[model samples]
Target: MKRRTAREKALQALFQIDISSTEPSAAIEHVLEGERSDDYLSKLVNGVIEHLDEIDQLIKAHLEKWSLERLATVDRNLLRIAVFELKYEHDEVPEKVVLDEAIEIAKLYGDDQSSKFINGVLSKVKQHLF
Candidate 1:
């Protein structure tokens, strides 16, 4: 599977975890069935969950006037995945690539403003982290 496809899966898994409050392991297993699973996608999903607090903090810091709870769940988690890729997975992925993929995902699964919102927040994250 392509990277964007993997990201879409990861986004869905994250969304599932958020909506159902299910365990990550089960959530991942449930989502990965019938789909190709790879180390990169696995790492992305698990890493985002593992570092959720830190990721959320970064997003929370960048989003002025919009709290994490107030943001749409899809937009919030999409930012989390992109930020995680930008920060912790830098060796394997480039910042622009992560941001681009995120913007595409946002356009598909998020509100009309999601792409702009994600870009703005991630730009701030890139400035601080890189």
Candidate 2:
């Protein structure tokens, strides 16, 4: 699968896990709809799950007034996936690409303000990480 498609699937799976407390494999399967799972997709979901506390901490720190739980499901999971990539996959994916991809994904799946909100928060995260 294309990385973008994998990312979208990962976002959906993570969103499910976050909102419904679904099992990761089940969530991933539900999102895949019988399509073969991609390695990147698994890595994303599992990585996010494994590092959830740290990822949420990073998000919580950068959030201006909003808390992590208050974030929309799509917005929250998008940030998690992007933050996972930014933290662990930076050697493979540029921070700019990660940020841009997160913004684009947020635009597609998030509410009207989601893109800007994600961008702002992620930019802060990027600065902090680098």
Candidate 3:
């Protein structure tokens, strides 16, 4: 699957896992809906889950007034995916590409302010990390 599709599927799976406490495998399967699974999609979901605490901490640190839990589910998980790519997958994908993708995904899946909000926080994160 394309990386964009992988990110979108990863976001859906993460949203499911967050809202329902669903198992990771179950969430991934649910999102796939019989389509062939993509390696990047699995890597994203599993990577975020594996590094959740650290990811949350990075997000929490960058947040202005918002707590991690207070952010919209879509925004929170989108940030996680972007941050995972930014921090861990830096060699594979450029940091700017990660940021741009997250903002675009937010525009699609998030509320009116989400893209801006994600862009702002992730800018800080990119600065801090790099």
Candidate 4:
């Protein structure tokens, strides 16, 4: 799968895991809907799950006034996926690409403000990391 598609699927799966407390494999399978499983998609979901606390802490640290829990479900999980890539997949994916992808995905799946909100927070994250 393309990385974009993988990210989208990962966001969906993570959103499920966040909202319903679904098992990771079950969430991934539900998102795949009989399509072939993807390595990147699995990596994203599992990576986010594995480092959830760290990822959340990173986001929480960057957030201006917003608590992690106050974030919309889509925004929160999408941030987790992007932050995972930014932290763990830095050698594989450029930070700019990760930020851009997160913004685009936010535009598609989040409120009108979500893309801007994601961009702002992730830019801070990139600065801190780099």
- Rate residue 52 of model 3 by lDDT: 95
Cα-based lDDT at residue 21, candidate 2 = 97
Candidate 3 per-residue lDDT, tens place, 1-130, comes to: 8999999999999999999999999999999999998999999999999999999999999999889988899999999999999989999999989999999999999999999999999999999998
* Per-model lDDT: 0.88, 0.95, 0.96, 0.96
Q: Per-residue lDDT for 15-103 in model 1, tens only?
A: 99998897877777787886656676788889999999999998888988888999898998899899999989899899999999999
Who is ahead in lDDT, 1 or 2?
2
Q: In model 1, how many backbone clashes occur?
A: 0
What tens digits encode model 4's per-residue C-alpha lDDT throughout 43-72? 999999999999999999999988999999
Error of 2 at 15 (Å): 0.8
lDDT of 2 by residue, 91-117 (tens): 999999999999999989999999999
Q: What is candidate 3's CA lDDT for residue 16?
A: 96
lDDT of 4: 0.96
Residue runs of model 2 more than 4 Å from their true location after superposition: none
> In candidate 4, which residue pairs clash?
none
Candidate 4: segments with Cα more than 4 A from true spot: none
Q: Which pairs of residues collide in candidate 1?
A: none
> Which prediction has more favorable TM-score, 1 or 2?
2
